[model samples]
Target: MTRKPTSSDHIVDEKFEPWERNGRMPLPVVWVAVALAIWGTGTLLTTSGGAPETAVEAAVQQDRPVDAPDSGAALFAANCATCHQPNGSGVRLAVPPLRGSEFPAQGPELVANVLLRGIDGPIRVDGHDYDGHMPSFSAAFGDAEIAELASYVAATFGDRDDGVDTATVADLRARAVGQGTWSGGEALAAAYPGLPPQPAFSSASVTPVSADVSALIFEGRDDVWACASCHGDLGQGVENTPRLSGLSADYIAKQLRDFQTGTRANEHMSFVAKGLTEADIAGLGAYYAGLSVPSTAAPILGGDLKRGETLALVGDWDLGVPACFSCHGPSGFGVAPNFPALSAQQAPYTASQLAAWAGGHRANSPLSLMDQISKGLSTDDRRAVADYLASLPAVPAGSTGAVAKEGDGHDL
Candidate 1:
């Protein structure tokens, strides 16, 4: 009889999305917002053309790039001040002190080399032993900038008046090619006996190696280890590592460049990528792309296969997640020069990548597609799709499923 329905008579939709209950902004978006706010505030302060009246204004003057401060001081403030305090008194038992230390006082060449090629392992400064890894800034800075940074550190911390020159830095950089992070400060001290001694690992020693020794660039040169050592010889990849065999050379080179620039963060990859020059990146990319390997990876994540299959092919429109194959290509064979083949990827690697995107650890995807899509996926959803992709047959870039042909631009 068409009576008004009571509150208890209401029914929930069968397609109700659990993810919609949360209203949190993605972490990356939040960071971007904060950065914008700081910039805006700094801009307002700078336009006033008066001494900073507030603490925020003062911070903006010292820390922000307002008025473009001295290059060396600015570089140190942005990069080094976080660990080594603004005064150069470092974190206790972690990063060693730089102020009044004899370390940087060694020589302009030594300081410049340290900046060009990082240092790590145990080091003693004024009777305190500190073990810390310093990343290479070579990729981030040109010879002139590095010279400025080195000269600044020496004058400020080592109390030296002799400044490093750009030519000296350029020459040192050329000689340091193919050398990975320095073993320790001790190694440097031994290499330049004029420097102060610090206890170091007995195994730590420096033997300068030329970059020209590699028969194949993919095999690496000098202290730069071979790509095949970690990624399989055929680029099949092992566990958390990604498969590079069927990827486009352009994509591979782009990723290495991103790693070098710290756009994508992976300690091991960044270290290795920093050591690679443009030619090395191009050669390695081509070398890996040319390789063809049967997928050795298997689904070990114990995800629901039916759910995974549905997600990979059909997608959950309610949760705003698109089918994996819509962009990856039919049968997940990949769309060549852009999208990567996911069919035979290791489940662990795939799931980790999805998590990284969702957590804002990775932001390199085109138009932030992966970051957006990953945010909508639950952990179970990620594992399900990863396992499903891993279960698919691995094929060459031009081949889809059981089919084999050519002229797809990824002919292997």
Candidate 2:
């Protein structure tokens, strides 16, 4: 104890922790420890990832803008609100309701093109018409203005998420420049080809043997096709066949009598109506006018109601299109005599008429604006617009023209 401590003695006396004592960890142990830590960290990260933030949350965190541009509201107010209205309910007969219309939501390009070009002559809007001049904005407004207006209409009135931009307007403007003015019939034909041919009315198949008033006139006689042959089996009418449902009995009776008396002339209808007796005409008129009109609502594909309203009232003048309400009447009930009511028509039936006009199947009248419009429409455009029309409810009778009730005089 008295002698000086040696180096060995000092080393034995020093306290050493477990880690300090070992120069390095065992290879396997080290690897296992690192792997465990990594796994734990990865699990934590995955759990956090599973609870992703919502778009609003992300925007809040990133400080992104959410409000629409000021110009969007301004453009809409100035150009679109007149027909669409501030509340977007749309006018009853003169214009279609924009809040639920189908054309604005079709796509930015389609909406833009319609705005630039305009439409004309008895176009249906929300089952109504705004048959006035729809002036062209293409020459007056720049791409930005059109884009802003379209964007506002699509988002606010159409209830769509897709936004319009300048690019879309520019593209439509270019297309309008290349194509001259378009009539409704021309537009429709250009859009949809391969439309089915009009079937000849078969009186033989339609004639009824029973003398029941409703059966004889509405049901037709054997060897004489019933009115329903070319019209819908339900009187809704098919492709190229006009809808007979919901028309006034007086109007219908008058038309039938006219056909028989040679007062009215339609190649197909003349032959059919000419053979009908007064009793037959009366029965048919009563049967059709008495029947309730079925609902024609279907899921619209690629349309926006807001845009439809605009096209209906304002029209795209640049494209030589005319306003729908001019001939169709303020409400889509039509002006009577020649114009057909457009509201509440079946989707299939509507599509067929557009296709017929485009294909030159139904245009026989010298004043047929439909033929001109059908030729101008692209297939896509026809579908978009017709779908919009099909979605609308029929206008009440008294808005623009006199309406005949079920028992009204025999003039549908």
Candidate 3:
């Protein structure tokens, strides 16, 4: 039935043709092709609205439509209770009280700005200065979330209004972007007129005898509060507070004597200075004047260190904020009598002061610009700006061309 002798019948081809080649397709290769085809089909199906359902969409479709609750108390408890405390009393000399604060009761715009931008530096509230920083909520929240927060604060802590809407939040955000960062209350007083005057501190009336006698005052006491308490341990203040660490002894003694005689009327300092004897004042002044100016600590506020540096020096036009060096000096080693040294101050302390000014807690300066400036900040901006300030190196003594000398009162 089979012809085996025929050469043509024998399956032998000396010249192989590409079309006649026979080989097994690799399992891996076949699998890869099938996978690619399936992927392409899935993509097409998805685009065509015939794709398989995702867990999220299916759940959303099946779930009941629930409205967000209108409970400010609940929202505050959930979000702000941790730092502000449940009763809003706040920490002593640390985080400021939110209850009954003018900031909360002022306007929705301010509240929204505070919530969005946060706060920094020496903020004055009800005549009391709070030197701490508030963190930002912009990154964590959207327009709707910001609206909810503003609405909650307005209804609960602040005077009740129609409530903050999404539009208001958006408007505030736009304005903030135009305004940039805010300066402390003291700076505002200096920049603007028709603002309230700064509160007066009581000055001491003690006369200096000699440096030898001044050193004796601290002999028995291991560590009592020094001239650095209100003036900053390093004599570098964020704002409002004056730097005294690198001043001449004469300047230091003069301030102490002024405080004793009621010439100055700082409530806190007047009380402290009144307790010191004339000899004690001379010794304290000498000690501070003799010490070297310390370096600034690292910034605690959240932001890019490099970016902060740029903003501090050059400022951001998009936000309508000014360069810090314009007023704070290039090295941040503040000038005497009013300007404070910002080089080595704490970041939180700086932030707190800014919030106080914006909220109208502290006011005793001649400038209205600070109020305007503070109104423009968001919480995030405040933190970033403050962090930059904190990152700056300390200005060495005599860096500002002031020589260090005992009884000169120019060491701080």
For this target, which candidate reaches the highest lDDT against the unseen true structure? Answer: 1
Lowest summed lDDT over 10 consecutive residues: which window, candidate 1? 403-412
TM-score, prediction 1? 0.45
lDDT score of residue 95 within candidate 1: 57
Off by over 4 Å in 2: 1-53, 56-213, 228-234, 237-242, 248-274, 278-294, 297-307, 397-400, 403-412
For residues 115-200, write the lDDT of model 1, one tens digit per residue. 88877656778777765456577887887778777888888888888877777888989989998778777888788887667776
TM-score of each: 0.45, 0.43, 0.37
Measured with C-alpha atoms, the lDDT of residue 249 in candidate 2 is: 56
**By TM-score, highest first, what's the ranking?**
1, 2, 3
Global Cα lDDT for candidate 3: 0.55
| Per-residue error (Å), model 1, residue 400 | 9.6
Q: Model 3, range 238-278, lDDT digits (tens) per residue? A: 44454455444555666677666765445666766677777
